[model samples]
Target: MASIGLMGEQGVSAEAVPSLHERDLLLRRLADLAVLPPGRVTPQERALVDMVMATAVSRLDVAQRCRIAERVAQLPEGPRELTLALARDTIEVAAPVLAEAANIQGSDLVEIVRVTSMDHRLAVASRKILPPAAIDALIEYGNTDVLRRMLENRSIEISSRSMEVLVRRSASEPELHAPLLERPELNQRLALLMFWWVSSGTLRVEILNRHAVERRMMHIAIADVLEGGLAASGADEALRVALSLVHPPATIAKPQLTRLVNLATLGQREEFVMELAREARLRPETALRIVSDFGGEPLAVLAKALGLSRQEFGDLIVAVAELRSGYVPAKSDIERITAVFDAISTDRADLVLHLWDWSISGEAQFPLPAEE
Candidate 1:
C-alpha cells in the first residue's frame, strides 16, 4: 500500500488548488450537460468524457465523467465502452454515479452488459443497483468472489431466482459461499441446504463464533435433516462439527421457544423437540404449549437442544408429567425435571412407554409473573 502522501500538505498545496479548480470546472460542465438538449454535445466528445470519468479515481475525474455521461445519456447512442472500463477499475466507483452520468436508463445498462464482456467489478456494481436485465446477466456470469462481495450489500433482496443462483453456486466453493450464511433471510430450500452444509465443518470457525444463535439453529437443523434421511450420513458429521462450537450453545428464548413449539411444530423432528423439552425444562403447560404450538414433530429439535438421546427423551416425558401433576411450573423447573430424567432413563422402554401417557395429561396450569 504505497501512500499518495497528503494532498493538502506543504509541497502538495500548490498542485492541489489547480486540481480543485479543474474539478470545479468539471462539476459545472456536468451540471450543464445534464440539462442540455440531446444535440448539445457531439457523440465523440461524450464518449471521451465517459471513458475518462469512469476510470478517474479523484472527484475531478468523477466530475468530468458525470458531464460526459449526462451528455451521452441524452444521445440516441449509448456509452458501453465507458461502463465496461469503469467496471474494470478497482477504485470504489459507484454504479449510480455512472448511471447518472450517461443519463442512461437502467434498461440501457442491461443492454450494455448483454453486449459487453462481463467484468467482475461491473458485475458487482450491477448487482448493487443495475436493472433487472443487467441483474440477469450478472447472475449468469459473475465470478464467485464478486458475487460473495455483492451479498454484503443490503440493497440486494434474496428472491427465489437469486436464491437459486446461490444454491447452485454453493457447491463450487465453501469459502466463497460463506457470506450467504450471514443473510438474515433466505428461501426455505436454500436455508435448509445452507444449514446442512455449514453444519458439516464446511463453514469457518469465525462465522460460528460470531453468530452463535444462528450457528446453533443451523446445527440443530442439520441434525434434523440427517435424521429425516435427506442427508443420511450427516448425523455424526453434523454432531462432530457442532462439537467445534467454541461457545456454549445459544439460549432459546423461553417465550419464542414456547411459541415455536406451540405454533410452528408440524412436520418438524420429534427427537429434536423432545431434546429441547428436556433442556428447556418447560412445565407441562409450557411443554404442551410448545408441543401443541408445533402441532407435532417438535421432538428432534428439542432433543438436540437438551443434548438428549432418543431414550432419554422418553424419560423426560415422564418427568414432565410428574412436574405437571405437581403444579404449573416455571420454565426453569421444566428444565430441571427433564435434566433429572436424562440422567436416569438409560434404556428403559418402560419409562419411555409411560411418556406418551404423561404427555397426554398435558402441561400444568400456572400464572405468569407480573411484568416488571
Candidate 2:
C-alpha cells in the first residue's frame, strides 16, 4: 500500500501523483531523443528510427520530420533491400498515426510507397502519389485498388504480358476493369493487345464494351499501334478498329489549344507538330510547313527526300518581307551559312521572306520540279 504525501512527496497514491507533468516530461524527452547527433545511429538505423517516429507521432513537429527525411535521403544506393526492411519496420510501428496524416498521403511522401509492397495500405497511400507510375516496379500485390493505384503512376510501362494479365483480370472482375477505362493515354499497342485477348476468347467482348469504357481511349489505341514501337501483327487492322469508333467531339478548348501550339512551336518534335495539327483538323503538310519556318531547309530536304517538289523546297525560306523594314535574310542571319553559300551564289532572294513563304506556303512553284 502506498501512502499519500502532503505537497511533494516521494511515496504517494497513484492518483495523487502528477500525471500531466510526467507526460509533458516524456514529450520533452522524446523531442530531445529526436535530435541525437548523426553518429548516434548508423544511417540505416537512423532511417528506421525516423520511420518509427514518423509513424508514432500524432503530428511529428517540423524539425523531427525534416531530420527523418534527411536521414532517409542521405542513404546511398546499392543496398536498397536493407533500407526497405527498415521502412517496413517503421510502417508497422506507426501505421495508425501516419495513416491519418494528410501530408503522409501526398506526393511528398512517395518515398514511403517506394519502400512498401502493393497492398491496402499502399492503395490508400497511392491516392496521393498521382499518375500511377510511382510504384510500377514496386507493386507485387494484385489488389485492383492497388492496380488502380497504377493509373496514377504515369511511367507504368505496360508490356504485352502485363496488359494481358490486366485484361483477363478485368474481365473476371468488372470492378478491377473500371480504372483502365478512365486513362486517356492508354496507347494503341495496349488497346490492340486487349482486342487480341478478346479474339483469343480469353476476354469477353461484352465486358470490353462496358459503359465504363472511355471513348477517347480509341484514339490512343490506334495511335499507339501506328506509332508505338512494338512487334505485332496487323497495323492496318488496328487503324480500322479506330475508325469504327464514332469518336466524341474533340474537347481542346482555347487555353489547351494555345498551350499545345506554344509547345509545338517551341519544341522540335515533328511528331508532336503533326499530331497537334491532326487534333486541330489541320493537314499534316500544313503542320510540317509551320515547323519548317524555324527549321529552315533541312526540313525541306527531308520533305524532298519524302518526295516534295523543288518548288516546295523554294517555299521554305524565312527572309523578312520588304528590305525597307528592319529585316534580313536567314542566310545573312547565319554566319556559317553565309560563308558557305556566299561562295556559291550572291542572290539572297532565296532568303527573301515573301519568296520563302511562297515556296513553303505552296504559292510560288519551284524553279524546277524535284528531279523526279
Candidate 3:
C-alpha cells in the first residue's frame, strides 16, 4: 500500500499562487452553481476544476484546503487526491468529507480510520453502508467514544460475531445497556440476559415490554397478564433448585414433568430441572446454570433435547420468567421463547448436550456461576 504523502512539505513555486487563487475563485462559483437546479457550468468553470488540481493543494491555507475538500467530497468525480489528503488532514478538515462523501470507497475509509483521529473515526461511523473489512477495523480501532457513535448510527452494520462480542462486553458496560436494549438487532435471549445483569431501572420493564411487543404485538395481553402477575406474586420466591449429586436413569417421568410445567410452581420448576440435568447427562449444578440464566435460549435448548412438546417449552419459559419477574411472560415473550425452542435442531441440541458434559469435565466450568 502506497502512503498518502503529507501535504505542504515541498512548497510550490511563487508563480503558481496567482493561478491557484484564480482556480479557487472559479471552484467556489461552480460549487454554488451545483446546489441550484440543473444548468450547465460555463466551460471556464470546468477548466478551473482541472486547473485547481494541477496546482499544489498543500500550498493553500487550511481554510482554502478544507473548502476544496468540502466541495469535492459531495461530487462523485471530485478530485480523489484532494479528498485523500483532506481525509488525512486535521479533524476539522476531514470530518465533513468522511461523514458524507459519496465518492469515498471502503479502502480509503479503512485507511483513513487507521491513520486518523477519533473525530475522523466518528465521522466514518455514520457512513450509510460499511464494508465488512471496514466494520472490522472500526470495531477494533474504535474507543468508547467511537463505539458509542457507531452503535448509535443505525446505518452501521455490525457482523454477528462482533455483536456477540459486544453482548458479552455489555455484561460489564452498564452505560451501554440502554443502547444495546434499544438496538433492535439484539436477539431477545441475549437482551434478556443483559437486562438481568444491569441495574434495576424502570427501563428494564419498558425494554422488556418493547422487546415482547416487537416480537409479537398480538400476544401483549397474555404477556401483560403474566407481567401483572409479577406484581401480585412479589419477588418472594427467590427460586432455588437443589438436587442430589447423581440420579438413577429415567426416574422422573414425562407426566410428572408435564404436571410441573402446567402448575408452573417454583419447587416444581426446580425439581423439573434436577431431573432434566440427569437426562441431559449434565450435573445438576451445570444444568442449573442454564435454568438460572436470564434468557430462554439455554432452557429452550434443554427442553428440545428432552423431547418436550412446543407447549411444554412455552410452559418452561413462562414458569421461569414469572417466578423471576413475579409476572407472566408477555405475549412477545411467549412467542419468542417458543420460537427458539422450535428452531433448535435435534442434532444441535444433542451436540450441545455432549459439549456441555465434555466442557464441564474438561477445561471449563459453567460460565455464569450457578446462583441456585
TM-scores for all candidates: the values are: 0.36, 0.29, 0.50
Q: What residue pairs are clashing in model 3?
A: 219-331, 223-330, 223-331, 226-327, 226-328, 227-328, 230-326, 230-327
State the lDDT of candidate 2 residue by residue for 1-372, as single tens digits: 232211122222477437744643343344333434457557776555445544454343334333333443333321233233224444443343223333332342355555554552454434433334434333344466666666544543454445545644554445544455454544433332232123222232222222123334555666546433333334553333333232333334545444443454444355556654555333455445435333232233222222323443233222111211323345533443222222221112111211222223322322212323
Highest-lDDT candidate = 3
Q: Report the error of model 2 at residue 211, Å.
A: 14
lDDT of 3 at 2: 38
Model 1, position 61, has a per-residue lDDT of 51
State the weakest 10-residue window (summed lDDT) of model 1.
345-354
Q: How many angstroms is residue 257 displaced in model 3 relative to the true structure, after the best TM-score fit?
A: 11
lDDT of 1 by residue, 1-372 (tens): 342222222222455678676665554444343333447568766666556544542354554443344444344444555544443333333344343344445665555555554453454443445555555655666666556665666665656667656655665555545677776655333443343234242342323223223334545655644434533436463333323231233345555544444422332344444544444543233344444421112332344454455564544343333323323345554454344344332222112212322322221221222324
Residues 1-372, model 3: lDDT tens digits: 332222222344557768875664454443344322223455456545445553545555677667666766677655555567667778877887787777678898888889888888888888887787777677778776776777887876677767655665665555666677767677644554454456553554444444422212333445546445445555442211111111111233687676656545654667766766666656665576676765555676667767777776766777766546565556765666666667655544544544444333321422443333
Error of 2 at 264 (Å): 52
Worst 10 residues of 2 by lDDT: 345-354
Question: Each model's C-alpha lDDT?
Answer: 0.43, 0.38, 0.59
Using TM-score, give the best candidate's number: 3
Which stretches of model 1 miss by more than 4 angstroms? 1-103, 115-128, 199-372
What CA RMSD would candidate 2 show? 21.1
